[model samples]
Target: MVGLGTMGAGIAETLAHRGLAVVGVERDHESLRRARARLAHSLDRAQGHGRLDPPSREDLLARIGLGTDLAAVADCDLVIEAIDERMDAKAALFARLDALCPPGTVLVTNTSSLSVTELAAGTGRPARVLGMHWFNPAPVMGLVEVVRTVVTDPDALEAVVALAGAAGKTAVVAADRAGFIVNALLFGYLNNAVRMVESRFATREDVDAAMRLGCGHPMGPLALLDLIGLDAAQAILASMYEQTGDHRHAPAPLLGQLVAAGLLGRKAGRGFYPYTAPDSGEVVGTGTAVGTGTAVGTGTAAAVEVPPVRRVGVVGSGTMALGIAEVLARSGHEVIVRARRPDAADGVRARVRTSLDAAVAKGRLSEQDRDGALSRLRATTDLGDLGGCDLVLEAVVEDLAVKRELFTDLDKVARPGAVLATTTSSLPVIDCAMATSRPEDVVGMHWFNPAPAMRLVEIVPTVLTGETAIAGALGLARAAGRHPVRCADRAGFIVNALLFPYLNDAVRMVEANYATIDDIDTAMTVGCGHPLGPFALADVVGLDVTLAITRSLYEQFREPAYVPAPLLEHLVRAGFLGRKTGRGFREHRRR
Candidate 1:
């Protein structure tokens, strides 16, 4: 092992515990001491958990030999380096190891991300050096990605794979590339989430909540960024952007600022959110700081002053409409819900009441809250009833023609200067604008599913949309207690635009059997730190919805890559509508 920080030490401890003699070489005495201490602590924990017996821990400790000499690993049949990410430093060490070790000795770099080919060629024995990346707290993380260069010896690759198995880590073989498979896919999503916050689209809390609840993610993007040091994460992403030239991996400005400020992560004194005291594990952020009551904003969100909003109008009566109405009423918006017909409107109102009451039963909402929320709700069969309403959100069906007709009708009847917004998740703002003669008066306000719970609301706008319209809609979403991300009119917009293609890729991976469903899910959740695997997320996102978005992207891009996966079609045909249908990749076989 070459560097003895947290990752290296964990890897060494894991190897030693598996009865393998580990020769760990660090440059300086202080570094060597830290590595040795970390390894001892890891082994002690393994003993405490009954995973390793006391005698085994002692043996494991005795087996590990720490040194500053590269020749120390000369006699070993296989050597793994977990050094600092500098190419020059690693190249120098590998050259020395290649000269000292026998030709058959397999060499590996436990680099999470770096070019394997470049690193491999650093040693004179190009066929020997490949990558054997370990996850943090490696003994427990259960993953080791073995990256192969084109020139890498097959036997060397096989030996590393066998060694990973011996060390009790799951191994995946991958082509050498920037960010490789895991971080390439992961960081793009994280960067987008940051842009969402940077643009004042949503608060960090709402953004994280929307992802966790709506998509079943374990942690929100912002929290994940804090965990993965902002500096290191940006470096990984910047490498991808430089290699692939994909704009998605382009580093957000805040990443550089935070890193420069030394607010790197839990290791640093602070990060995107600060830790009260690093070792205390108590973290605080803008809205959630210790000893502070007020929230910070980007001038705009701070300036938004919500009017004494009494009655709110909703121009649809579907589940989305009902959900929005319930959430609104629950938060004290006197909901004037409109459906096309009297029975439909009444049905929506009843559903909203039942939802509220269920919350009461679940102790999510008290009886007083349920009553207060319901007291403000009123069902209407007329759009004209919204004539004097302070705000009107159109949660109608997502057809452009249907939404345009409603907007035209509302254009004539809505109270002058009342915010006319569409909760159309996928439609363009300009298309919705053409329907209303006053295009500047219209904007897009999207809410995630189960509106009462999900907090993200993308406030999309066309060029014609006025600042006042943007401000008013943004204010309403915030007042409704939603994190609203603002964006220009585009197909699929931000979340779906980026998220759907990834889902399609997962479908492709499954179709290829590159990994089993369980393996892929585990690789993502445990290996890459995702809340759930893409397969699980796909089930929750719904096969039908995923298919629609994939087809839409294909229609726009005309790329074979964006084509919908056949498995998705078959699943939808089979009526496996995820948790709702109680069947998907894994059966949601009741409580």
Candidate 2:
């Protein structure tokens, strides 16, 4: 190991724990002492956690030799450079290591974004050079990306894979390229989050909450970027944009400015969110410092007094409708679900009951609470039943005509001043509002699938939407234990607008045969810490849905990038509508 920074120290500890004879080299005596202390601290923590006993921990520490000289790595079979992400600095170190190490020694770099092939070419042992990119906190994260350059020896690549497994890591191989596999997909998404904030589509907190709650991501994109360090993120994104020439990959101006001002995330005690101390996880305030209140550019969300909602009406007999109704009832509101027929209304009731029962089985709800929620829920085929509803949410099919017709009927049958919300993910909210006599009452309340679990509810208001309607939607979302983000009524709104294009690009990557499905999936999940890869997500979302979203985006903006991937279109045409049909990008068993 070379340069005993965070990555280097962690890698050394991991290797030593695996019983490898490891030599950790640093530049000077002071740095060497710090590296050894860091290693000791980490091992002490492991011992405290019962992962390592005292004797075993001491024995493991004995396997690692820390020194201030590169000559100490002379007899090692493999030397890994885990230093700063600068090409010139890394290249210089590799050139020196090449001269010092023995012949055929596998030289590995733990670079997250830089080109492994370029680093390899800087030395005399090009064929022996490869990337053994490990995730942060190497002893914990189980992933090791084995990057093979075109000139890399197959034997050298295999050796690293074997070594990674011996160190208790799952290794995935990838061709050497900018951002390689993980950072390529990851940093772009992070950059988009910054852009979303820059455009004021939503507040930074709301953006992070959406991914954390709505998408099941462990951390919001901004928080993840903060943990990764803003300077490091900017470097990775810059390298990616330079290599791919994609404008979307370009670092957001706000990100660059933040790094320039020395607000380099947790290391500096601030970046997207302020911290109480350097490297602390605790955030300082309610909202990000970059924007006032809940916005940046076009002013903040206006304060409006919202009327209380008692009875909520949900229209539709589909999964979303049942989920919404369940969520409302669970939130202590009387929920009336309206379907087209008596049988359909009965089915909706059964679905909601089954969902509530499952929640009880999973310990997410108590039996009493389940029964109470079911008691508050009623299903009826009559629109007249909604006349007393304080709020009526239309969770119908995605046809403009169907929604417009329903809104027209709702405007007539619903009580005066009742807020009308449509749960449309793609179609224009303005069109639905235009169909109703009270356009001011119609707003878009897009709830993610399985509304009871997902926490995000995008409150989209059209041009003519009144402040009371906006307040009502936000208030209801909060009352139902949801994180609400207000966005203008536009194609894709907040999340989908930024999300679908990336998924489309992933499809394009597959179409170009850049990598296999399993490889791509593994790369994103293991490397970037995504809950699911784009392909798996596309499959879960249904390819037809992805295509429709992409088409809406393309139609609205006419951007070539938003155009649906040909592969995606072809699969949808084959009736491979994802998990619904038991097949899509990959095979699945029907539920």
Candidate 3:
């Protein structure tokens, strides 16, 4: 192992833990001292956590030999480089190692985004060179991206894969590309988040919260960027943009400005958010924690005083409508669900009962609570029944025309001062508002699917929307135990705006024959700590719905990157909607 920095020390520890003898190298004596201390500290924590016994920790330490000379790696069968992400510096080290090491020794570079093929061309044995990119905190992370150049020998690649498996890490192979598999899909999403913050479309806290609460991501993009040093992020983005020439890969201007100011993430105690000290996880200051306050963007809705909601009306009999009604009823609000037909309304009541019963069975709710919530819910087929509702939420189809027509009817039937909200995910809320005479009363309250479980609710207020309406929607969302984020009436709002584009990029990766579906999914789920890979998530979200959302985003922004992938469109056209149809990027069997 070479360049014993944070990543290097982690990798060295991982290999030594697997019972491999590792010769860890650094630049100088002082640097070598720090590397040894870092390794010891990590092992100490592992031992404290019961992950390693004292004897095993001592044995692992003995397996690692620390030095500051390149000549020491000459006798090693394999040499891995984890140096700084500079092409010139890495190339120089590779050339020097090639001269000193034996002809048959395999060389690996742990680069996140640089070109592996070019690095191989400079070596005396191009076929012996490959990229073995590992995630940070290598001992804990489960992935290692094995990048294979065109000239990389098959035997060398196999040896690396076997080694990774023996070290308890899953290996995914990718062609020599700019970002390879993970960073190619990950950094683009991260850059888009930075652009969202730079444009003031959403606050940094809101962006992170949307992904965490709405999409089930382990960490929000901005916080993850802070954890990854800002300077390092900038370098990766710059490398990706230079290679791909895609403007989306270009680092956002705000990122460049932050780097220029030396606010390089947690290492500097600041980046997107302030930390307690350098290299600390304890964030400082107000409004940095999630769910503390409303994340209102510039020109977006603000929190204001509004009348308390006592009675709520949910329109439609679909899954979303039933889920929303359940949440409202459980929150002590009288819920009236209006369906198009009497049978549909009855179906809504029956489904809610079943869901509540399951919750009771799982000990998530008490029998008394379930009975009380059900008693508070009513179902009807008349629009006139919603006249006395304090707030009416429509969870109808995605068709804009259908929503506009419903708003027209709701305008005549709903009582004055009642908040009218649309649950559209991608359509314009302004269009629905304009269909009603009381445009000031209409606002967008987007709820994620399975509304009773997901806590995110994007509060979108149109230009003509009233402050009373915004406040009412925000208050109601909080009352239902949901996190509300305020943004302007725009296509895709917060979560979908950032999410679908990343899914589209994954589709493009498969379309270009750069990587296989399973490999890409494994890379993301294991490498980035995502709950699901992009393809698996797209399948669960439905390909047709994914296509529609991406189309709406492209129509609104006219961004070429937002254009839906041909493969996705093709699957939708072939009637492979997703898990619903038992087919998508991968096949599924119905239970």
TM-score for each model: 0.76, 0.92, 0.96
Q: Could you give candidate 1's per-residue lDDT for residues 60-93 as a string of tens digits?
A: 8798889988778889988888788877877777
Estimate, for each residue in 7-116, the C-alpha lDDT of model 3 and write its tens digit: 99999999999999999899999999999889989998999999999999989999999999889999999999999988999999999999999999999999998888
Ranking of models by TM-score: 3, 2, 1
> What number of clashing residue pairs does each candidate have, in the order they appear?
2, 0, 0
TM-score of candidate 3 relative to the true fold = 0.96
Worst 10 residues of 1 by lDDT: 289-298
Query: lDDT: which candidate is best?
Result: 3
Clashing pairs in 1: 201-484, 201-485
Model-by-model lDDT, in order? 0.76, 0.86, 0.91
Give the Cα error of residue 154 in candidate 3, in Å: 1.7
Query: When superposed on Cα atoms, how far off is each prediction in RMSD?
Result: 5.6, 2.7, 2.3
User: Candidate 1 has what TM-score?
Assistant: 0.76
